[model samples]
Target chain A: MENSPKIAANPEKYTFILFVSGMSVKSGHAIENLRSICDTYLKGNFNLQIIDITTDRQSAVDYQIIAIPTLIKTGPGQPRTLLGDLSDTEKVLRILDIKS
Target chain B: MFNYFHKKNQTGVRKIKPSKPQDEKFSFPKTPTGVEGLDEITDGGFPKGRPTLICGGAGCGKTLLSMQFLIKGITDFSEHGVFMSFEEPSKDLSLNVKSLGFDLDKLKAEKKLVVDYVRVERSEIEETGEYDLEGLFIRLNHAIDSVNAKRVVLDTIESLFAGLDNQAILRAELRRLFHWLKEKGVTAIITGERGEATLTRQGLEEYVSDCVIILDHRVIEQVSTRRLRIIKYRGSTHGTNEYPFLIDEDGISVLPITSLKLNNEVSSELVSTGVPGLDTMFVGGGFYRGSNILISGTAGTAKTTIACYFANEQCKKHEKTVFFAFEESPQQLIRNMKSIGIDLEKHIDKGLLQIHASRPSLNGLELHLLTLRKLIKDFKPTTVILDPISNLITVGNENEVRSMLVRLIDMLKANNITALFTSLNKQNDNLRPDLAEESVSSLVDTWITVRDMEGIGERNRGIFIVKSRGMGHSNQVREFVIGSKGIELLDVEFGPEGILTGAARKSNQLQRTVKAMKLQSDLDRKDREIDRKRKVLEANIAALKNEFESVVEELGILKATEDLHSKIMIENTPKTKKK
Candidate 1:
């Protein structure tokens, strides 16, 4: 409804957190880039929790994320899950059900 | 309200069928601003044929940049342009830009450019019941069509905003204006005075949100420097840097401070900076032809002397060179350097070196860079010298100076030209001044500092290499001397005390005190002479007083004799008065 350049006025719906390993040579780049995309598109709506499983192997198991690189939608009502580094935004959007 | 409801009820309504949404693609020609740094930052000139919303504060070079944008499009890009001025007339625009070598009126006559001045004086017109901007639109269209304009600039929209006050009509007209620009499919610039964080006074950000560029002219430390920043571009990959820009007789040329590249390839060819001793400091005894050397020191600390020696070396090496003197004129500089035996005149005569001396204040920093750009392009010299770049900071702020240096260094490096810069530091306690221009220091391949060291009885000049990137250079601070023959690199004098600063002459008071004591002894003899003169004056005063008393006594006796005579006469007169 609001038309300011910063038009994402609604932030209460989603809390998405993205976890990252660090800016390393291999796996870190994927995590870092994914963080920027989430921040840019989701803005305040989605909080990105990027847990670096490369460092803390226990956290992945603790969150029941068995896959090495996995994204678990921890919100209520049929929490859809996805695998891989979240590179493909379309597939990620389908998994997260983000409106265009 | 009841009458409207009854009328609607009497009419009754039927739902119309919904139409399918259509996706229509349209293409618009984009006209690049051609404002130097702007095009680089925006990544290849602004989208040609699209209207860019350039808004910023007053005195931010809005009108000037817009005009330059149009002028460059005409002159450089071979594109036709239409300039619609809401501020000044066509004559003023031409006059104002004539200094820039942009013959606006000539271009107009040549049918390459067209300018229409919409003198929107509020007093000239009477308001009608319902009006439109068709007249203004027609005028703009006529101007555009006449030139077959590929570029158009609306100097300012606020002038019309002030002339008209009907909010509804103004809003509708402004929207129509932007849409009409897109409809024309011509690249255009609609400049507005920025209000708050919004794009324009009318809040046209949402309306023309396709692209936004902001121009800012800030006076940091009393020096006005311009910077252009791109806020948004709908579909473009652009560098986001608030780059320093300059306005001069030419036009707005921005200094692209940081180009995104990390190619640090060191050249193999050893180029001497004309000074053999200084060259010996580097491991290779020279610099990569394009290396930047910073010779910094306090006044008379030999910053310029060191740089002259370097320039002299290049000429000796038979390299074609240009020295951009920021401080002294060519003749004066040559004379001073001649005293030190650098003899730049020889190089000038040989046509091996070119001395282009100018006051940094003569033009803005970017203009200086641009003139350098032009000179470099034409001369294609292998070596260049910016004698005392610190002077540039006076015309522009520190940041501007730094950015200018960055771009200059990049240009020199990209061309593989050896560059030397002299800096006169003011009362710097630290070996380095802010060298906030230090940001460019990293970009430089070599950093040299000439400082004054205090020896026991005198000050000696010392030159040291602070850093030379990708090459091993001398770490030792070598004492140096400038003499009639030329500059000689004195070995670093090592004693119990570390180093003596140069120009420490006449600093010790021991010799001064000895001279003062000798003067005091001479003054003591003068004091005796003053005493004799005081006694003589006292004696003369005493003698004159005694003489005066004696004369008084003599006068008293004479008065007694006169009184006796007067008494006799008075007795005789008194008898007559009684009758």
Candidate 2:
């Protein structure tokens, strides 16, 4: 809700959906890493939705998720996917086309 | 470590139990793949509940083969399957196989199959940190559970290597994946791209070690052939030879060339050789029911005519016959045979005969053999004829042709179907059997050779039996004429210049008739002379008898006169004499 004003000001909305398979360490780390990056860099200008594929497998299939802790960055640019736990924040931001 | 957490996650998910017990794993059980001729080669099918590596080059039908396995599994065995394609999406995969009559959507709707296409694009993803392929595991688990699948196909799983970057993680994951599939108790097929040196580009053969099959497509002399060979199979004996396979409208069919053992059942029955004279040459009056007959001859020696006669005879007996003509087209053969009074078209219409004609160069020797095999399987004919198998030599060398014929004859013999093959020998090699004839002569049960016996300024066709196994046969050469009615064998004519035929035989008959007429006239003249002589002698004898009688009467008169004069003295003398 706090990122609403920024979301309207910036027409390029960073829509991110993270697909994970359960409450595993990698999934938790990936979710935390993606949130921290969005809050710090795109503050109030991004929308993030986390999906647990173990519970909602249809979405995992819809996103074509193969590796766990996968973050798909859609809208504002070409849709790109970041595999693994998103531990390398700099590389993820670069691949997602986010300017620091 | 990550492995410990993986174990906990797996246990927490569903308390999964491996399908087979540890001790029972040694007992090999197979799930039959419904592909024709495949089960026989594999000794059964893929090792059940384990992964099989199918490595092949591009466009060699690797994906199609795996798709068939999955579809056939569901349709034929009533076993559910999960197809995880790593290259093509589900829709494209379905469309690609639609022509093959695999109704993937219907199977999916019926809850008998699940198609999960795992699209991996390198440009779309960036590897950040250490990642386990737990997502793939979960998705596969979900699909398997949804369909309750007993079969799984990960077509071209080697694509994962190009999608991911970290070698260590991918290797560990692939190793685990095969193990997981085995633990899941589902028969799985993992396809891989052929490598230059190794069986698979990623060395997937190292991971899935239970069974490995290599599919190859090689083009030689502009003719392409697809072959399949089993590199290794644990716990079971399998055909190790490279078996040629075909991909047609029906799908892939592997032709397992040799049945290996010569244990086919034999039949004592006999089938007519179509030519009545040719049949008489054999003591059995015909060829053995399941025997292989070879008719080797020079060109224009009535070899095809003889073959047509045999085919006509079979059709007359209401037996199914298949004639594979390599030199002539079907219409041409039917027309040519019609000249010899053989009606092949009628038999074709009646569905009792099938004339499959193709140029020997149309396909590779293996393809021709496979086509013949498929025809025999579908038609289930009681008799098969290959007119002029010598034409096949143009497509392959002598050894290849001989081997193909061996397999073909073996197949026919095993099924108790009588087969006949006509071979054309070169004109120069008239004295001895040529390469083609000698190669096949030993394999045939009966060999009949038709040759041109050159006579004085003319040539005559001589038909004789070279060999007839298990039966007595005439050794004399019989003259055969290809007339409008059919092939007719004439009686053996022995003349001063050996066996005569054609014009020589006719002229010999004429000379014998002339000689007999002259001798009969001479005998009639001698009989007249003897009659004349007998008449003259009888006349003379009558005259002599008259003369003798007259003389005897005179003598008796003289004796009477003397007796009268001497009667007085004779009476006295007689009394004295009597005293």
Query: Scored by CA lDDT, what does every candidate get?
Result: 0.70, 0.86
- For DockQ, the strongest prediction is 2
The TM-score obtained for chain B of candidate 2 when compared with the true chain B: 0.86
User: What class would a CAPRI assessor give candidate 1's docking?
Assistant: incorrect
Best by TM-score: 2
Regions of model 1 farther than 4 Å from truth: A1-100, B1-29, B75-78, B264-266, B297-299, B356-368, B389-402, B424-441, B449-453, B462-479, B490-579
Question: Could you report the DockQ of all the candidates, in the order they appear?
Answer: 0.01, 0.74
Give stretches of model 2 more than 4 Å off: A1-12, B1-27, B522-579
Q: Chain A TM-score per model, please list them.
A: 0.62, 0.87
Q: Could you give the TM-score of chain B for each candidate, in order?
A: 0.72, 0.86
lDDT of 1 by residue, B1-579 (tens): 353355345323311111112234232224566676676677677766667788899888888888888888888888898998888888988998888888987888899998877666555333322344544565676678777998888888778778764566666666677778878978878888888867688775334535788889776555566788888765555667787677766677777775658574557788776665777788887887677877767778877777777778888878888998877889998999878666789889999989998887876776788888878888889888888887777776666677778778888887888888877777666655555335456766687877776656676777898888777987788877777877788655443345433433223235557879999999998999999999999999999999999999999999999999999999889988898
Candidate 2 on B1-579: residue-level lDDT in tens?
475457447534422233335466543589888777889999789889988888899999988998999999998999899999999989999999999999899999999999999998887889988688888888899999999999999987778889889878887888789889999999999998999888888764444546788899998667778999999876566899998888877788888887889999999999988886778888889999989999999899988888888888999999999999988889999999888788999999999999988888889888788787778789998899998888888877787778888888888898898999999999894378887798889999999988998878888899999999999999999998878888888988878878889898999889888989999999999999999999999999999999999999999999998878887886667866776
Deviation of model 1 at B349, angstroms: 4.0
Query: CAPRI band of model 2?
Result: medium
